[model samples]
Target chain A: MDGIDKTDRKAINFSEKLERISDLWQPRVIAEMNDYQFKLVRIEGDFVWHDHPETDETFIVLEGVLRIDFRDGAVQIGPGEMFVVPKGVEHKPFAENEVRLLLIEPRGVLNTGHAGGNRTAQNDRWV
Target chain B: MDGIDKTDRKAINFSEKLERISDLWQPRVIAEMNDYQFKLVRIEGDFVWHDHPETDETFIVLEGVLRIDFRDGAVQIGPGEMFVVPKGVEHKPFAENEVRLLLIEPRGVLNTGHAGGNRTAQNDRWV
Candidate 1:
């Protein structure tokens, strides 16, 4: 078998990857496309208001509800739904129950953005 | 209500968007982040063997089964699974049944890459 390795060519399963994470709000990188990374995260409760001044953030909900509050309004995303929070807009993500999410953004972007605090998770963490 | 318009801040539901597309293999842009675009497409047959020399391509399966065949191997992606086809790697996607997918790539990339023909879809079509 001189071709692409079978084990290395498997698809990244979201549910399987999410099961490897126990901590909330910590995003674990699963795949990358060019300079962007696709991360899987689980969260409940409120997140700090922050803005990725350099890039837009995408949130695709896999399970439960995710509400992202902007300064003027909010968007509630459920399973099979997604939203793109534009760059430089301050937003806060809140979940009443556990929510599984797939976040897509540039590689170096932090979880807390510029709001950096105790809630900030380490960057480049892969599952 | 001078805030973010409620009507304009709704989430993009994958199932709802897929319902609007009756054609197969035509990816319609649903959202954008920076220079990249997120597209939704329904496919049920074989696609042309092609390669994106400028960037990688991401395929996130929302429904049904999708198998991407590389020159030497293949990756089977099902619902909740994803695979990124690296730049310059020739591949063909096939599906036994209808498959709904979320494709992420740079804005100008075509569905058929450089292997353009009748199968090539119109670029920048939004849903």
Candidate 2:
């Protein structure tokens, strides 16, 4: 079928997703569709408190234990677990062990959580 | 802390994504944001050749080997690998072993590949 279309989404591998992030706290984009982007991040220990003001972000844990502390409730996401933090809701993420996670969010989302800091990354650094 | 915004995307689990699908050849919507949708599918043997006329689809292989036969060449993707089939391209997927995958594409994507089939499904199924 020369002109037949595959309605199925093309497959993307995770190892390549891992190749994009080299350090903790920094995330690099692996793929993008329309206005949304998929990112991969490696983390260990505590990260600064932050929030995206305009978009909700989704996290899928491929490895390790991850904890998210919110005002009313906190959630611990382990291997295979995912959570979405609503936009503008304050939260902090901490991982005692090294973790590999996939993030889906909009483009230009700040890494420092919100606004500015020396921790804020200007451009995505690929691994 | 009571008011810290978590910077990490809240984690969403895959087992839960699996619970959303019930049969083979059928794809179920597990989650969505904006115009894009995340789907889970269980597939086996040969599927009808088809394509998405508008949006490019993304596939992430969670288990088993999947073959996407393109016009000029074909690719076999296994666990942890992914492939993005460009839009308006003719292709068919097949698996000798049962395959589980994640589909990330736009809403209202036709399952029969490009158009109508006795197999075309409407409304996402939740298992």
Top TM-score model: 1
Tens digit of per-residue lDDT, candidate 2, span B1-127: 1233444334556767676666888888766655667778889998787887776777878888999888666788888766766678877888999999877877878876665777676756644
State the TM-score of the second chain for every model: 0.95, 0.84
Q: Which portions of model 2 show Cα errors greater than 4 Å?
A: A1-12, A16-21, B1-11, B16-20
The whole-model C-alpha lDDT of candidate 1 against the native structure comes to 0.93
- Clashing residue pairs in candidate 1 (N, C-alpha, C atoms within 3 angstroms): none
- Predictions in order: lDDT: 0.93, 0.73
- Whole-model lDDT, model 2: 0.73
Q: Estimate the TM-score for candidate 2.
A: 0.82
Residue A107 lDDT (model 2): 80
Span of 10 residues, lowest total lDDT, candidate 2 chain B: B1-10
DockQ of each: 0.56, 0.33
